[model samples]
Structure formats: C-alpha cells, structure tokens
Target: MEMLIVVAIIAILIAIAIPTFASSLNKARIATDEANIRAGYADVMVNVLLDDNYDAENGNASTAGQTKYYLQKDGSVATTDTNAYKTQGKNDSATTEIAGQKVGAWAKDKKVTYQYDNTKNQAVISFE
Candidate 1:
C-alpha cells in the first residue's frame, strides 16, 4: 500500500512540474530572441558608422550598406524599410531591421508586452 501511494505522489509531482518547466523554457526562448535582436541592431549602428567613414574617403554619394546583420545610410541607421523595421521614434512607420532579418511583432512592441525589448540602444539583454 505504501509503495502505491509513493508512486501516486511522484506522478502528481511530475504533472505539476511539467507545465512550470515548459513555461520557463518558453520564457527563455523569448529572452534569447530579444537578445539576438538587440545584437543585430548594434551591428547595424556600427555598420552605419563604418559606411560614413567609407563615404568620406571615397567621395561617394551613396552612403549605405545592408547585410544579414546590419544596415546603414547617410552616416546613420536607416529606418525606412517597413519589412525590416517598424515604428521608429514612437510615431514613425514600422520600417527597420533588427539584425538584418526584419523586425517581428515581438520586436515591434518594444518588448513592453508579450514582446521583448530588442533595441540595443534602449533595451538590455542577459543570458542564463
């Protein structure tokens, strides 16, 4: 009889722990997505600075560069690609890229809701 009771208790514990563990894992995924986005944005900023320097030396009218991880234009980051970035400066259209992969809903809300703050300049990312 005691053995049966022990098994039942273990079963209950497993049931209770599974959902919590799953939820925590989901949260971790969201956190990782946020961090990736922020890193991409930082890369974009750096690319912009580099492009500006290149333009200064080459005397080229075009001052922009785009890749899978960064974008730059006219000495600063470009925020005009809706497919890439959305909602710039709070009132602008969603036209930008985070890490060159196009911003998603989680990145658009500024990570204030179900989303995560993916902006490198405005958000913070930590690892487990």
Candidate 2:
C-alpha cells in the first residue's frame, strides 16, 4: 500500500513538472531566436556601412557564431559558419518582408544575403 502511494505521488509530481519544463524550454528558444535575429541585423548593417567602392569591401567577414553578410553577390559564394541556433521561420515573413526585414536578422542560415533597396526611401536603414 505504501509503495502504491509513493508511486502515485511520483507520477503526480512528474505531471506537474512536465508542463512547467516545457514552457521554460519554449521561452528559452524564443529568446535565443530573438537574440540571433538582432545579431544578424547588426552584422548586416556593419557590412553595409563598410561598403565603399574604393577602400572597404561591401561584404562582411564571417563571425564566430554568425554567417558572412553581403550587400550583393558578385559571382562568388558567401561564407557561413555553423549557426549556434537553428530555428525555423528564418526565411519566413520575418526575413522576406520589406517592412519587417526580419530575414536580415536571421542567424540560422548560412549566408546573410541582402538586396540593397530602400523601398521606403527613408534614408535610415533599420530593422525595426
């Protein structure tokens, strides 16, 4: 009888813990995704600013946890490292939209390829 009670208690504890653990895992995943996107955007912008037809190159060097960013391809392939975070929706609406530019910040991909176009013509290049 005592063993049965203990088993039931253990089962109850596991049931209560599973949902909480799952929730935490989800939150952490979302946080990591957000961080990756922001980092990707920053890297892309830095590479763009370094774009000088004379002195600096238009492409960015590959980071430790990030891919190489390029303004426009010049018949050469872009470089990429093993992205620490592999998340879905990297090429979804977030990356494909002009308003969101979410793809600009996706770190899950191998290459941060960008088409330099200011559809808004606001003169300010930002992800937000």
lDDT of each: 0.41, 0.42
- Compared with the true structure, the alpha-carbon lDDT of candidate 2 equals 0.42
TM-scores of all candidate predictions against the true structure: 0.46, 0.49
Candidate 1 residue lDDT tens string, 7-107: 99999999999999976765665555445456545655455445543353433323333222312222222333323322222212244344434443443
Model 1 vs truth, CA RMSD: 11.6
Q: Write the per-residue lDDT of candidate 2 for residues 1-128, one digit (tens) a residue.
A: 99999999999999999999976776675565455545555555555454443122323322311333332222222233333334423322344333253334443333334333333311122221
Q: Which run of 10 residues does model 1 get worst, by summed lDDT?
A: 119-128
How high is the lDDT of residue 107 in model 1? 30
